[model samples]
Target: MGVQWSDAADGPIGGDLTAVLAYATPAGGAVLTPIAPIGLRDRDAGRLTFTTSLGFGRKLDRIRSNPAIALAYHDRAHGFGASSAYVLVQGRATIVERPDREYLETVVGPAAARFLGAPRRGPFWDRWLAAYYADRVPVHVDIERVVTWPDLRCAGDPVVDGEPLPAGPPASQAPPKKGAVPRVDVAKGARRLRGMSDLLLGYPGADGRPWVVPVGLRADDPRGYELSAAPGLLHPGARRAGLVGHRYNAQLVGLAMRQHTGWLEVADDGSARYAPHTDAGFAAPANKTLLLLTNGFLARRGLKQAQRARAAEAAT
Candidate 1:
């Protein structure tokens, strides 16, 4: 409840600016990438559309091979204590190349109206989007399933083709998670992952949507943990990366909050095992000391940055 916006009006979709499109790769892993939808939250219809270049992108290939995809959005403006409200949309997408004037005016027109501050006339925004839309495509994601955390009251069920989609387990339900990734609290999750020297980040690539690339995570004060991906793996408009070492590291803190039960134990032989809460002899002490040292380093770095900025201003 960081900022008060009626759930009935906005639902859990957040604003147009706050969403990530996720699709499965040929290898079965998932890549969560950001997207800006042009349409308003249509809870009843259970469908929303986004505008993207129809160029030779990895997502386009994945969609052509498999239309089943998911979009996850969380309102970062507001915070619900440790957790944030989020929505997961599982759907099929249809990409229309060289979309006609009629479809843009009728479908994506009204959605673009608010941002452009103009009516849905083809000549206006159509030409504007043309520069990017030329040979590009508009992907209309048909919502087959919609899941939200901290469910809020809405006007109607998310419907598809005149029928309401079946409800899913509440987001709070942990469910049976596979893998050795031990669940941890949202706050400590990223910090713990930052301790790892080498981790893998999955994003869309020529190989597949969830192409895995190794990365190193280091914590910095004021900025939190910073992730550096492999060379050429990071590019503009494709900043989001999924943690590969374990799914428990959690995604962006603002997206979904997780609960932790125990931590992972790494042996001298490089073998890793989940440590129960009762096991207190492992690296708990060393881990705590390391985290404190990292925090101190970050604080010093922040101070240095601030001093440099001040020095530049004085010189000017």
Candidate 2:
């Protein structure tokens, strides 16, 4: 009833549990923040476990009264109720501006920009965009053997099933013909040029280097995009046509380039990996590739990039 920690080889480690904990949410309320209980260590060959939520929020009562706090994952909450059964992990939590890269690599490892809430992820080509990583700050949450509430059930769908999403659509969506390709049609492909954040531009007079820009200049259809340089950053073939028709085709292309929004891959290590280019995604094994939902425009983006490169070179 109180706390149980260590267990044996087959059975879960328990009985060594130390303390009970109370969680503090970001916004602080009855809601949850999808708190993931991760056991990060200094090595790779160790047993690593974690839990991810669809989306949850937390309350910050302990942070207000007492900074020193730890708690088991909450099962339910109200004005006055039994503290949600959980393993209490009382550790120091603070954002560290100065981080040793080696230490970070050991504990948290690396994650896609999406996890850190960056503008874009993929193979970022712009110097300005790449520099954004310079000011990054890392969070450190010290570890203490908290609770192991395997019996405690969560309110939302916290089941750690085979795949993240549910099985699939109804059987009706299955392939109808024998030789027909079962299309993953969810991908609408090419995003419109409008509001397209021109991360970089290699137009004339910006020197050999591409012009740097924020998420400036929207894509004005496939024809071209505006630049953000003093003179402006415009793509060489910014004069393409039928952007309206090309949109659905280029949607996925834009996504793969956006790096920030590349396709998610369930890695062998059980962590999700993201690739900025289509080649990286395709090069993976079938099991890995099966996780990705590719749109037809991925190829088109590569072709388009090549054409633009040739056009830029000829003009030079």
Say which candidate scores most in lDDT: 1
Q: What is candidate 2's CA lDDT for residue 56?
A: 11
**lDDT of candidate 1 over 1-316, digit per residue (tens):** 0112235324445353435566665534455444446444445555566766533355566677777766655433322122334455556787775688676666566555443334323664454434333333578667655544442221222222222332321111122245323333333555555443324443333323223333455432322234453233333321223452222111111222111223222233322232211111112122433433332343445445645765788999
lDDT of 2 at 209: 13
Q: Best TM-score goes to which candidate?
A: 1
Q: Where is model 2 poorest over a 10-residue stretch in terms of lDDT?
A: 239-248
lDDT of 2: 0.25
